[model samples]
Target: MNNIHLLDLIQGASGALDYVNSTVTGHHRRVGAGAAAIGGAMGLEGRDAADLVTAALLHDIGAFSLDLRLDGLDFEADHGDHARAGFRLLSVHPMLSRVAPLVLHHHTPWHRLPPLSDPGPGQADTPAAALLANIINLADRVDVLDQVGTRRVVRERIRQIISHNAGTVFAREAAEAFLDLSAGSEFWDKLSGDWTHVREAVDLPMADDLISHDQLLPFSRFFALIIDFRSRHTATHSLGVAETSARLAALAGMPPESQDRLRLAGNLHDIGKLAVPVTLLDKPGPLTQEEFEAVRLHAAASESILRSVPGLDDIADWASQHHERPDGSGYPHGLKRDALSLGSRIVGVCDVFTAITEDRPYRPGMTPDQSARVLRDMVGQGSLDADLVALLLDNHAEVAEARREAQARAHVEFERYRSLRVDGAAHAA
Candidate 1:
């Protein structure tokens, strides 16, 4: 946990965001690569360069908050809501605070942006925030254009659109930088090539040092907010599960460190849900076999994303194994009781409790007796660990109350986020 690299975490989180749609599968990585190249050509180096690329990777993050789909591929779509939402979400992050302003204006037109005074001798020639943001804007559109057609056609069209929009949609310098970079076959090769090679091509600085455990909480919660905020029906689900799982872990006599890890696992258990379509998630009737199969990929998706980051193996296992059953009936993997870890069982129990108790778009939450009965039946059928199920059922009042309080707080945050989207749309209009 202590040895997790900052860049790996950021990449993993961005990877989850990429799962939101098929059209934008690797959009963030390409944008990050493009921004790095453009920023370098503009003489951005060190922190300025790194922040710009980082912001590019996360620029569309507000899509989840706004419940947006693939509209980002439409160059003329209204992106103000997602841009503002990304700003609001990133502003509170401890390590990512500096990039918030960059993400905030990633969609702003060059002509509409406020002017900035040139920095003193030691600083970069341009104000880093403004220039960095414009770099992302240019890179983003370039990648979007790249998605429209074959390489030859897309390259020509990219030149035309970028040339036309310079000084309007994009800053003149950034646009020029991008045009120059994209003229080469090398640029397109890296853009369409592997991300590791892209980083080397652009000389992008990735933070490889270990991040402290204290920093993991905010990032975990950041992910939880993104995962749950995709729909009104699920706005507070991850928080409920996280808090409930933590309480249950405590009651189970787990050590303090294990409890903290379990909390992180709880917050991120459904991260793969980002890959699932909102229609499937909110559908009222039972899922068709095809739909159920699509939904079932979430657990493996969660494990894949989490495992991509170093030193998060324990957390990843705990989070991804939440669907496993003691009788080897669970999906993604059919681990039996002997194969399941206690941490995994704890998160699994909490997830079930939260799901049954939380209100859905189609129905009200189940009563305590109803939820308890459900849990007990699962215990009896070997679907869950009996002792853990009993612990949650016996202290139902306390654990359920903790979940309520946590989700209540999360709801307020969600409402505030909604207000930001409304205000942002108005501002954009």
Candidate 2:
């Protein structure tokens, strides 16, 4: 329950997740580790910086899929779901309540998203989380472009990725900073461009990262609680969504294994928002351009976080692709409908449904009718599939009932918390 305990839990959880995703996916891990190092070097306190490193390491914690065959994953889709899964699992744990939101919304963009800033000194740490998210973001690009601890080719290739993003994927500030970091020596090369020298440069976390599936899953579940702690409104949002979405997906005829992955993806769908400022998250007014820009980064943040794991690429792929629309309106990647899979598409709808139906600090949960109207509009706009919307509408009663059941569990938790409060008071006597 103390910060030290929480930190230990986080370290174990993150290290395990990092091992699985990195080993299985063959994407870089040290970039996240290195990014955390930069934050530590930049004067973040030991715990905070280490937490950042763990976050950096396991941010993509949702990307691994238990059922996914490893050969199908390239560097692209496998590790994407880690963020959402990671956030939801952490949200339920004690002491880690604060990190929950950052883990959830680290990919959150500024402006008109969940965790909109609220007016007050009592508002939580969304902004600080956002700052760390930004640091991780730039660090991710820097690591990829520098190829972190790898060869020069990978770094050069990273520049090509940045160039490709041009006006999208990254904002000018993010791009500019990344470009500056990309400059200088061979940091832009493959992860081992300086293999002989680099092996001796600094101790890497790889060995510690090696982990079994059983060890990794619980660790991931732990961080899910941390992500939910980011915002009062979103505390249980990811978990509920994942649970209900998986149930719905199965009811809608998805296979058991597919449903499992969907559940994982749904659990951490909003993992990136953890990095946004709480002020912005709870803000009641319209956001300035800067704030809005911050909101857009959440999905990308989610994607980067997931990439650090070992074998969870399938999970990451589906989860990270949720924000991406069929019409190429999504952030992180302007992936159009063709690029997205059936699982990813289902997640997109589930995320929208849960986000709107759930209470937000800024607005009331939309009525089913209201949520339906908006989703219908989205379908017409080519952002969503009209047929899928219709299917969801048909299943509205089931979805609502499921959500209510989940909410009831929270009421029980609330009562338990109240009981603890009373007990603690009596004990003080």
Candidate 3:
């Protein structure tokens, strides 16, 4: 496996979350950058800073998972439910577990914060975690501060708000760091302007410290949950495709390394769909032409999101090209048979097969024989690769069984997350 930067992966995931809602687009990036600046002002410049940035970038992930509407809401609006949900989501992964508690208490006011010696239940309760959460809380509010007039006026008003809330809504040290940093115009300029490249401004962990493929597979599974759990229609789509595609790739005699890439591609193939709203995804009827066109853009979006990471170019290509046809007629790109790789072809075939085989709100799932006939028809139309279609037909039982097993696991995960959301809401109420 190639070496990949952990910061790059976090940056890519931040971009993916932006697509969840247009109103909150770029929200995470701004918070991450601002939080890093605060960390630096407080004399944190190494792994501690990097971890703070990572927490900020993924702070809003639980909101995406819950399909919450954040548009037009105040910066300090009630978000405890989503914050708790985010804590639960990130606590499960080894790489993200340390940062999980920071996300949980990001919305907690400074006055409400528990003492380090007596931190409340489920809280990490360390001084470092508390400081990190406070930094993130202040940074998040800074990004969402209402701007109604000139830039200078808005900046001054935001500074006043932070200063006024010091020792109450904001931690004294964290608030002081932010105020000292914001006293100059450069900080405000960077915060309000193009800040997508802010990750480059800070010192992140070295590429050598990056996790290996084995470690990455679990993170990818966690990502699949974030992508698929938003809607019942897509609750198990990524897992089904991943399982079926890997099985088909093995049947085609591909090497194990190549098969692994195919499976990763399968898990991320529809990651761009995160940009599409749950309303559109779960619509029970046919999409209008405009909606269909909007849907087509997801393929290109997926490619753009994955391209940001340093390595895994092969996985990005295969995942993005799943929509391209063998003929020159497919969407996003009109690449013909010569341009598409075998891995891409395999993913394309499995994607279609999985969609037809899975039950949808609009229609029931088709039987294996029924889905096979549809795949064969597509092959006849020059849309799908005939050889890959043959692989599916010859091993229909095994392929179908793999898809079923994977989806079963995904369904259980989705239910668990659903229960968490409900419980969080009830507790908040």
For this target, which candidate reaches the highest TM-score against the unseen true structure? 3
TM-scores of the candidates in the order shown: 0.90, 0.52, 0.92
Ranking by TM-score: 3, 1, 2
Query: Candidate 1 on 100-122: residue-level lDDT in tens?
Result: 76776787777765543332233
What TM-score would you give candidate 2 relative to the actual structure?
Answer: 0.52
The candidate that wins on lDDT is 1
> Cα RMSD for candidate 3?
2.9
Per-residue error (Å), model 2, residue 144? 26
lDDT at residue 401 of model 2 (Cα atoms): 71
lDDT of 2 by residue, 257-354 (tens): 77876776776666666555556766778899999888777777667656434345666777777788888998778998888887788888877787
CA lDDT, candidate 3, residue 84 = 77
Q: By how many angstroms RMSD does model 2 differ from the true structure?
A: 16.4
Using lDDT as the measure, name the better of candidate 2 and candidate 3.
3
Q: Comparing 1 and 3 by TM-score, which wins?
A: 3
